[model samples]
Structures are given as structure tokens and as C-alpha cells.
Target: MNSLPDLLRLLAVPAFAWVAWRDIATRRVPDRVWLPLLLVAGVALLFEFFTINGSPTRRFFLVRVGLSAGLVVPLSYAFWRLGGFGGADAKAFIVLSVLFPAYPAYRLLEFSFPGVETALGIFSLTIVTNAVLVGIFYPVALAARNALAGEVSLRSFVARPIPAADATTEYGRLLDVGPGRGGLDLDALRMYLRWRGHTLEELRADRSTYRHSRSLPEERNPPGDGAIRTTAA
Candidate 1:
């Protein structure tokens, strides 16, 4: 019974794993996923309070949980507002703060857990710190993912690679034919593609279609306006 709260909190790990997979695939998580975790954490916390037999111990528990939550919620919110965190990621952190307000220390089925803790022993903050530390390997992870899929692009770490046949339907900006692409100076070509509402692949499929346009947006003018009106070749 003494370890019930910690075990309940442990449920959050697998829940977050599902959330991470969903976030990577569709960037969406239904609100329903969090409510159950929150409910369990709340109920377990109340049970822990009731189980406590002394005033000082209960007060200490309250102080630990309250301080952990008070510190994490604001920091997660600030990161979300600054665009440094996704809204789902921010919510995950906040939920984690509630679920694990303080370190979980107990032996379960003969397996000792959390043999050591940070100086503060604030579990929520520890989770955040570990997340930041793990994030340092994200670039390497990206590179590896792209490599395994044979997406050996110069911008593989940051860009998504799709077949040229699906360029019109795919959701991403042109990387190979961007305005800033050097050598061939395809910037003008890029502007022309934008003005004509065409993808580079479409133009390349039949250059004769886009090579002779009725109007060409001047370099200084907005993409929609084609004041130059000289056959854009």
C-alpha cells in the first residue's frame, strides 16, 4: 500500500510512449488520453494523504508535491509560448508534473528502484532535466532515421524527402529547387513556379508549358503581380 502512488505514477510512462508515437505520426493526441492518467494520479494522491498517520509527514508531502507542480507548470507554459515546445509536449510535461510531483522510491517484487536522486529530489524537475539531456541526441536520431530510409539528402536532418511524382500532393516546400539554391540561380525559376501555381516537377515534366508564360512577376514585385509581363522563360 505504501508504494501504490508510485506504481500508479509508473502507468504514465507507457501512456506517454503511445502519445509520442501518435505525435510523430500525426502530430495529434486526443484529450481523452490525459484525463484517465490525471484521474488515477489524483485518486492515488488522495489515498496517500489519507494513509498518512501524522501531521508533519502529511505537510511535508504536500509541500513536496505543491512545490514540484508550482515550478514545472510555469516553465512548461513559457516554453510552449516561446515556440520552443509543441502544445502537446507542454501538456505532457504538465501532466507529468502532477503524476510525479516527487521522487518515487520503493521496492517492487524484489527490484529496487531509483537508487539515487538529485539534490532536490523533485521528480517533475528531474523528468524535465532528463528530457533535455536526451534531446541532445535528437540530431543523431534524425540522421539515422533518414539514413535507414535511404533519404540521403544534404538537408536530411531537417528536410522531408518525397518522390517527385507526389510533389504536388506532398506537404512541404521545395528543397532542391528553392530560391536560395546556388549555381543555377534557380531563384528566378522558383519565383516563376510560385507565380504560375506550379511545382518544379510539373514544370520539368513539360517545360514548354511554363517556359512561355503570358506574364512574369518582376523580381522586386510580390509573387502574384506580374508587371514585367515579358514571356517568362
Candidate 2:
């Protein structure tokens, strides 16, 4: 028969693994996984009380376990609210606290005298293993997905804008009529000016408005206005 601490350790180890796997694969750890582990930890504690001969120190350990479990609930809720940890991660963290109970100091795993050192070692090992798995498999999976999809290289999709002059020339080529094409047609320009509600003859009568009209100054304003206002030539 496994001792109380041994069984607790075993239960906790696999719970940690399941939580990590859930996060890595689907980025989720459901309550089903951690809730059972929490119950198992509780049962392990009850088993310890029944099987092991009591001493004041053992009773104190029981108290620590109770306090750890108690603290886990609120801490988990707070972390979930703050977005620091997901529900499953919170449950996993709670399980770790219950399993290890000594904060700031980790416990080294063993049947007797598990302390903060072991907890730290377990935490460190878990991190390393998760890192190694992600590093090895993620890139390979990405490459395979890209290959199956027949993804093109990024360079092929790059779009550099043509220079402004080149862009204008290309547009002109499409609309080209012939060499020495005359400037804007008077009738079309006049119709467009009327559409914009501009009166060409009225604009010509005013120096300020005529100068600012869209038509060229010589074409629309002309020298006639100044010529008629003679200052003895």
C-alpha cells in the first residue's frame, strides 16, 4: 500500500500533466480534470488520518493541508478575475498548494519530510518539460500545415507602389488619343463648370473670382477686362 504522502504526490503529478496538456493543445483546462484531483487530494488526506499513527506534528501537517486548500479557492478566483490564470490553471495551482502547502519554500518529494525544495524542483521540471515539448513539436506542425496548404512565399505577395510619375504616365497611355492632343475641351469644361454651379461669365466679371476659377486665367479672365480700364497707354 502506498503511504498517504506518496499517493498524494502521485495524484498531483498526473493532474499537473493533464492541465499542461490541455493548455498546450486546446488552450483550455476543464473543471472535470482538476475537480477530481481536488477530491482525490482530500481523500488522500483522510487516508493519512486513518492509516498513520498520530503525533502533534502530523496534526499540524493536516492543518497546513486544510489551510492550503482553503486559500486555493479564493486565490484561484482572484487570479481568474485578473486574467492571470485560467480556471483550469487556477485549479491546478490550488492542487499544487494543497499537495505542497509550504509557500515561498518548496518541498522535495518523499514519503517523509516533503518540503519547499521538492515543490520548487517539481515546478522547475514542469516548466522545462513543457518548453521542450512546445519547442520540438510546434515548428514541425507549422511546417507540415504550410506544406499541405501549398502556401506561397511571402515575397510573392509584396506590393511596391510605382512612382507617381510612372503611375500618371501609365494612366495617360490608357487614355491616349494622339500626339499634340489639345488641352481640355471647352464645351466639356463649360458643362462641368455649370454642373458645379459656377457661372463662367459672372466669374469673369469679378477679378477675384475669375482668377480663382478652375479654367486657366488667360482663357477665362482674359486681358480684355484690364484693357478696357485704360490708364493713358
lDDT of 2 by residue, 55-142 (tens): 8867776666666656655666676788655666666666766555532232355443433354323432343335446656765665
Instruction: Give the per-residue lDDT of model 1 (tens digit) for 55-168.
Output: 998998899889888988898898789876788888888888888887887786867778778877788898887776776677677778899998876677766666666553
Native-vs-model 2 lDDT? 0.50
Off by over 4 Å in 1: 137-177, 180-233
Quote each prediction's TM-score.
0.64, 0.41
* Residue 43 shift from truth in candidate 1, angstroms: 1.0
**Candidate with the greatest lDDT versus the true structure:** 1
Candidate No. with top TM-score: 1
State the lDDT at 77 in candidate 1: 92
Candidate lDDT values, in order: 0.72, 0.50
